[model samples]
Target: MNRLSTNIFRRSDALKSKPDTSAKQPFRVRTGFLILILSASISLANAEPQNQKNEILAELNAAATRVETVKASLQVGIPHPTAALVQWTEALVAYRKNPEFLYLKGYQPLVPLYFLLKSDSDAFSLFVPRVYKVFRGKNKIFDTSIDIDIALIPQDIILALKPLRINDTDHTEWKLAKDQTAFELTVKDKEGKILRKIIIDSSEHVRYQVEYNDAGFPYLEIWKDDWRDTGSIFFPYEIKMKRSLPKKNELVLKFKEIRPNEKLEEKLFQDTFPKDAEVVELKESSG
Candidate 1:
């Protein structure tokens, strides 16, 4: 016999004393029972961890629901490492309802600029008075989809509380920092690649910092500080964002006042352009 036929005959010979076909039903039934027991054991093992995760999430959601809105007057500074010039501007920042609306009006020396981040549309609009230009798109003044500006405009405790992916924790990993001062949560993609990391202090029960990769070699770092109680929730009054694109530049925000749950007008969120403004619709990139 050929090698393939000989190998098959050897396997058949090894099973020559197999249980009688008439009694094979018992063996099949027993094998199936064992599989069912193993499946149940694995399912129970998974359910317990899921329940623990849900409890932790519930506590965070409760704390985040306290604040409905936040408005602040911001003094922003942008420093240039290569040059001695440190540009400064003032802006009025307002955000309402998580993942809803964000508004900003920058009072630049040359001309005032207005920006609106509308999460419902997954886009942002910028109105420049100097050139009377209105620019709107996914990739403009700031990235739209990831909604990173949410970390800046309102910079609320809700952000730390919001879970990125609730249904699947397969790619989510969290642990206490080595120093034991803060807890860090790392989110990954399906391919097991790291997406971002969120770090919060358990003692303060608030997010202290966030680190993530941007369009640069070194990672981006954001720090929240100058916290004050607003009756409903404790919020950060000042935020510092630093980036290294071969050279380092930083954006510092100092809030003079922050009013939580403040009432704002509907017209404030509209994207009404000036009569002389040139509207620019950014073309979708092929990439």
Candidate 2:
């Protein structure tokens, strides 16, 4: 009887020491693992486009902040209803609304024209400086108030990217498209209208841009080439511009020298017309 009790106690101890083979895992373990993997894949895919857009915006902001003012030589070709008048001259083309003046001297009588675009109004005004007897009455012929269609503000590549960086990001939308050879970015408004379309090659810099009108039609196009870096800024030495409305015209501006961020006075941007000269206001439409 004593031997039988000892064998039974040993058997009971052996049963307690055995592993719990009957227990089961949680119900959703496998499913949770699969969902986690899918979420990670989606996050990686979405991050690519966002990264590309941020890179482009950063580049644009860097270019815009490099200069406060610009002075260059511009050759403008003005197309009349009948003939085209081509003029090559030097200009102080301010980038930050400091003041812009075009000095035309290739003609028999020199005419110095100043350009002012009022942000308060939807129009841009042109005025000539009040000339004294030095012009020999030749200044009167050019002393006229000319207003052209305000469809698009005529700007170079550097000035053109200013609004994109400064304005509210919610008002802007960026879309990317790519082909086998090149890539393009279309910047749109809140209403899904294309404001500007930029094209790039392998270098990934802006090579060309087409600006649109309110009706979503291409109004002006700019092409930039021969980029030069002036320590503080990088700008294109050769710029070509073409317009599609009002009067068909083309301008090729070659910068023989570019002066960036020159200190200018506040009085420069104000109207500098002579008080005695008769002011004639002329209005032209974008049509």
Candidate 1 similarity to native, TM-score: 0.59
Question: Model 2, poorest ten-residue lDDT window?
Answer: 133-142
Writing each residue's lDDT as its tens digit, candidate 2 over 160-276 gives: 423234234434444444432334667776677778887755445566788777777887787877777766777777776776643454666666677667764556546554566
Cα lDDT tens digits, model 1, 75-120, are 7666665687666778877666754666766786655553333332
* Model 2 backbone overlap count: 1
Q: Candidate 2's error at 219, in angstroms?
A: 1.1
Residue 31 miss distance in model 2 (angstroms): 47
lDDT of every model, 2 decimals: 0.56, 0.50
Number of clashing residue pairs, candidate 1: 0
User: Which portions of model 1 miss their true places by more than 4 Å?
Assistant: 1-59, 81-85, 108-120, 139-172, 188-195, 205-220, 243-250, 284-287
State the weakest 10-residue window (summed lDDT) of model 1: 147-156
Candidate 2 regions off by >4 Å?
A: 1-51, 73-86, 97-123, 128-182, 284-287
The true-versus-predicted C-alpha distance at residue 45 of model 2, in Å, is 17
